[model samples]
Target: MSTMQPILRSLPRLPAPNLWQSKFKGSRARGHLRVSVMTEDAADAAVKDMQISDHPQRSIIEIFPGPGQLTRSMVMAGAKKVITVESGETFQESLKALEQNSEGRIQHFAMNPLSDPFDEILLPEHTAIPGLKPQSWDKVHEDVMIVGSIPNSATGERVLHELLTASIQRMGVFRMGRVEMYMFCYKDAVQRLIAAPGMPPRNRVTLLAEAAAEITPLVRPGAAHFHLPYDYQLLRLVPHEKPKIETSVDVMDFCLRSLFTNKSHALNKVIKYERAHAIGSEFLGHPLLGPGAEILLGRLSFDHNIKVKHMTLDQLNEVALKFEQWPLRPTVLYDDMIMYESRRKR
Candidate 1:
């Protein structure tokens, strides 16, 4: 896995294609442009900033390594093993060249990284891929790193959401270790990650990312590292060493989504609407509701109009802790508790 030259220097020069030039149906469409690192220097600098050199044993899983600029950089950086999932066959020749040069150190799969589940790709048993090790659910390893850039589109959002969901659920590749993500995404997405309590645009994604992991910004928007017109961001995400709140991923998702439906609604109104109904009543009775659960029933005189967006991470964690105390878990049901309130008012 060691390379004498810097990773980029080791890579043979390849044509960097623009989105319009791509033959992939999805890529040729408007507003689905892929932002690629056009130069080896940029790629090398990005990897260097990640500081992966100290961990020579660390492996990488790259998504959509279009044109192989960063792919070459990672390989040159001496990644123990590089596994890539690329759906489009357009870059086959260059990617194949990389695979051959790496001497089996790089494994390329011609599958859509978004549609394919990580379990089948990362686990040996789940996948028939030989020579791979089986990862256990209870075990943890931090050697695996996920690195790549996603397109700036709705599809890209879904792809990122899927990756985060996998991490939160600790399934597949995530189960193999404490997976780390080094990603290039829209600046707005980065804002969502680091948004503080009472910040504008705070919503479900913000809560889920903060609850599941610690997000750190590697590069801010408008950085000189990128050659694109729109601002892009580089970020790193790793699960919390010791989670502040112990709860299932489902509860977090259901509770947060239900509460944040109307982000501007006061917390008191939100809670009352949710708990006053049949479903809320049943949820309150659950053992996880805990002895002190009744305390939440009384609305605080201060901040009676406090919205979900106004709550800090600590406050959100506190809410999660209280809800987890409930004994019986309720299935997530989508209902307009607000509409019910409106009907009652009428």
Candidate 2:
């Protein structure tokens, strides 16, 4: 696949971008929201920034995709298929609209995602993807899966499971441009239900590790999480003994710093993560150095966190071991303006 104009624009923007500027580079930065932050614009920029491999032979595959300004931009850029799953016919339609109005081709299919036979919708050209009996979209650009508090709301479960199934295989193969899995998010319940479908412990660990690999393989959140109003959380497929937040930096910094001495003074890593993400193949030999360090890295590294607190301690240990080289970080920080928003809301 030759570099298309769409591809050019999709590439991640350069370092230290000015948030207020028109070329706002990142998708989810520290801001005033309480959920994941990837405007259609940010998402679009991500796809473009993650240009299809220069190899021209390695294809791209996208999972649990949604429609909006950014997704539309992806289809236009020449991604063969952005296999997204949605249960609601209406949501599917809304997502398809981006493709419909786009200069690109899009295929939207209505799979209950939970049990709906995927075969009904998946076709060579359309975007509805079925179980991984692979032929290839061959041109997959990036893997995009975000598990966060804001959720798809309407049909998240169906969409999440299906996308996860599709994306897990690519966990290492394709670098995650953005994945938002976390503990507090409602998705945690969904994850807990699925972790041991009689699945192997090692397999689960592999998935968790791979998820870490996929999400941050390319993109990294900044020194600060998104602003105050924006919501974000860290998740694990299994549980662990770590600090977490229902809201804000004060409590967050307190807990983590108490656990790790320098955690408080350390500059937010969100910016570094984002910049490193653009560079690709993330390996923090000693990414973190503290009790909270592993937890922080795992949460921020890939932009995805799985909820494991509800799981058994045994399960937690199985997955928690990775905190040593945890992929996430305490990189995200709330913006000053977002602080004002919180006060205003009160």
Candidate 3:
């Protein structure tokens, strides 16, 4: 029986080809974006790496689980329950079969985790697994975990950015408390997600992600699978019990976008240039200048020539909070109208 275990664990052939290819073409085309763990060994390794058996009470929310390979591994590894949110229909038959065999342990939701609002999809009644309860904003929810493989494409990047933003705002899944995320991301995206201040890859996403969660790289990129064009690294993003940045998500977004326009430029110079209608002039009255700027720099104990890229996460948080509290700050920042319309629709 011990010897036969290896053979029993072998994986089936890869999923259909069209399922892996992006639907869009030309400039918008991202070739073979959907990467899946093709072998049972890889699937089991991922489940083990994520420590599925450690928390038997925690339910998993899996995104883009192609052919339900890792999904089965999670269940076999002792996951109490798995709620699969798969956007594509190509794997529905396989997922439905898994659900039928799981004796209510697995549930499938045909929704796009990226675009669909959690409030609309992951309703309390629908995800009513034992031990999973709403937790305070400053507490980590140990009962639920999110797992998935992110595609290597613009769509994937945009979704990750939105998720980080939602986390910072304590909206969506994050509203249930500091829900933890274990995701397989392309190597470059993982680099940017975990990049620190002064790192070349540090950008708005880096700042937002750092402000929202404690991101750890659990697995380094390995040899690419036959169906994948790039190697994917596994990341564990645990939302901070209390977010590092206390300002509104809009304010933080605005500040990061403004500062990172010329990330290498001196902080004072950037503010002065911005105020002078030389950079980000549309947001001229932003609090990144005048007394607000002076106070932020004073808090950081940094000289006027300090580059924006060199500021730490706390320093960046200070900038955003100061901007938020500025008495004379503009009533609206860029995209305020767009956001307002979006909220109205919802």
Candidate 4:
């Protein structure tokens, strides 16, 4: 038998699948979470497909790693260190067992990626661990990577949204550098994430995600894995060495949210309806959108009648940048109440 077989066999079995149902009772009942317990074979296949062995020095942060099945696969596949972040109490014991057997290769932490403060988890003290060191803000941190399965619900979309926002702002784990992410997302959400200009689902999420990273679909959903849902897709997100959108997160977010509110309306009409004119009376005459410009509304001279959803990523980014540079722009684009209490200090 291969050496990997014995290592895999030595890992503890996952708790009964029924236990997952109970643990995620509320989320499952609301159809907001889909629990897929990967068979050992499926777990191995996923790790192989992800090419984990190619970067043996990189630390892997596995989110919601139930019972450490995928965690074990990564360890056996040549991952030198695996930090498992699990929110639910259901699998702590099993994960602890794996940590013991791995001889310090596996570290388990109880934290929710969706709601918890990442600053608390990725503390400066933790950077001493191999592959957890921070890198310059302008460079990609080649040593760090994140892997997780996003729920096939609105909750899942929110997770992606928050992560993308964090990346744009260079906050959270992104503070270390532009870390890479591989996630299993709902197939439909994946489409919306990488959607191009004029696509049916192109909106705020698409614009921000494309601006922040290079997103690609790596694995299509199929029946190969036990309990693997048919509507999931494995996606890779590598943040740009420097994101294209240079404006503050609040400014860009406000512009995108306002513009996409009536995506089908003409750009000028949407701006007017959103009352964005309050920012500046001469908004139309701004250099980015002046009559001499090729794209009158922004630096690129496009027709004023273009539909909001049809604008290219660059065009959307130009609009946000222009808003940020406007002389009469409001001091605060968003209400302080919307920010998390912990983030105010930053």
Q: Write down the TM-score for model 1.
A: 0.74
Query: Candidate 3, residues 1-346: lDDT per residue as tens digits?
Result: 1111111132233354444445211132563477665556667778888998787777888887866778888887777788888866666777888887776778888787777456765665775354355787566677787888887787788878888877877777776778888888888998888887788888888888887788888765364441354677788988887678778888888878777766887777666544323434243433333434554555444465778888888777777787778776667677543443354358
Error of 3 at 59 (Å): 0.8
TM-scores for every candidate against the unseen true structure: 0.74, 0.34, 0.79, 0.79
lDDT: worst 10-residue window of model 4: 285-294
Give candidate 4 misplaced runs (Cα > 4 Å): 1-9, 15-26, 124-131, 136-140, 221-230, 275-300, 336-346
Candidate numbers sorted by lDDT from highest down? 3, 4, 1, 2
Off by over 4 Å in 1: 1-9, 16-33, 123-142, 220-229, 273-296, 299-304, 321-346
lDDT of 4 at 146: 83
Leading candidate by lDDT: 3
Q: Tell me the alpha-carbon RMSD of every candidate.
A: 6.8, 17.7, 6.3, 6.9
TM-score of 3: 0.79
Model 4 per-residue lDDT tens digits across residues 1-346: 1132223335556655445444433344444464443556667767877788777667778776766777887888877578888776666777888888886778888777677446776675665243365787666576778888777676777788888888887888787788888887777888899887888888788888987888978765363443433356678898988788867777777778767755777787555433323233233312212222223255445675889889987777777787677666556555532342224236
Prediction 4 global C-alpha lDDT: 0.69
